[model samples]
Target: MIHNLFIRTICTALLLASAGCRQLDEEGLQTEVTIRLVMPDSRPVTCLEIRDETSGFYNINTYERTAFPTPDTNTATVRLRRGVYTFTVEAEATYDDGTTCLLRCADYNQITQAITWVREQESIVLLLKSVN
Candidate 1:
């Protein structure tokens, strides 16, 4: 009887210990991005799509436009494949002349931010801007 009771106790202990670990590995392992939108002629724009080159992951947002011609912050959660990434943004904006430049600051600044997600991390914000 004692031997049987000991085996049950050990099994219960193992079960309880397993519960302490995280069940969902992807729970907090999301990449968040924030784009500080700006216009070609210095204006605040909204409704844009952000795409990661290294990873074929993208997110769209309709973040509230900030005060008068300033970059407003937009937040998004992305599932990264675990490594450094170069984020690219495409702002659906048209100038007064009705010309869409796609809104990229510069080729050098193509990689707005680099993130390494070894574990679950909070939302990461990327400032959205365009070439001056």
Candidate 2:
């Protein structure tokens, strides 16, 4: 149970909107994730994306990674089968906050665990603030 707030910069989200649609019939499962991405901080997040960590694996986005509100309001959506997925949360909190915080870089973003569609979700709260 790694529930510590470990923030770090990794890489940009994997844009998986190349094809129009992807087939998941062989897997024998179907689900739709209603992801509500919100920065619990005092300000709104610039942008966000949910992409798989493992390269070459099935993409989180079936058609496009920039889906506005597929599952719910204003959050990007990714529809696929029910299984474990290694994904990260990529979003620019702010560009010019006019501060001197060393941990305000883009690489200092947070990520979620191995997301599963079958399990019941509580809530994903991201507290973006100065690491001072």
Candidate 3:
């Protein structure tokens, strides 16, 4: 009888410990997100702005150069808790003919859209349209 009772007690303790650990993991969960800004032709842009609508946290990055030679120049990776976000990008885009125009983020024919970030890792791509 004592041996059975000891086994039951150990099982119960293990169950409770596991449950507590799961709760802790959920509360501290964070996701690494990669945000990419591109033009309609899949060309990378040099300016980016991201805002977490739920927490009002925002980040902005701007480069002086007009051309982004590499994909890394227009991509940003950040660690964020689960939340909805708004991405805004504005930059000067130079064409092959030496023409320049202002570009801004556009999603589904809209100027800006909310993106939900909930997965362990996410890659978000935003399109930039000519603002002029």
Query: Pairs clashing in candidate 1?
Result: 28-120, 32-124, 34-125, 34-126, 35-128, 36-128, 105-131
Off by over 4 Å in 3: 1-27, 42-71, 94-99, 106-113
- Residues 21-100, model 1: lDDT tens digits: 54444445444333344444565434444333321232213221111122234344444434454444544455545555
Q: For model 2, how does the per-residue alpha-carbon lDDT over 20-75 read when each residue is reduced to its tens digit?
A: 23333433465555555444454443333222231111334342132223223335
What is the Cα-based lDDT of residue 56 in candidate 1? 29
What is candidate 3's CA lDDT for residue 5? 100
TM-score of each: 0.38, 0.38, 0.47
The positional error of residue 86 in candidate 2, measured at the CA in angstroms, is 2.1
Backbone N/Cα/C clashes per model: 7, 4, 0
Angstrom error of the Cα, residue 126, model 2: value is: 5.6
RMSD vs true structure, all candidates: 9.4, 19.2, 10.3
Where does candidate 1 stray beyond 4 Å?
23-39, 50-84, 94-101, 104-132
The best candidate by lDDT is 3
Worst 10 residues of 1 by lDDT: 59-68
Ranking by TM-score: 3, 1, 2
**Distance from true location, Cα of 10 in model 3, Å:** 26
Candidate 3: pairs in clash: none
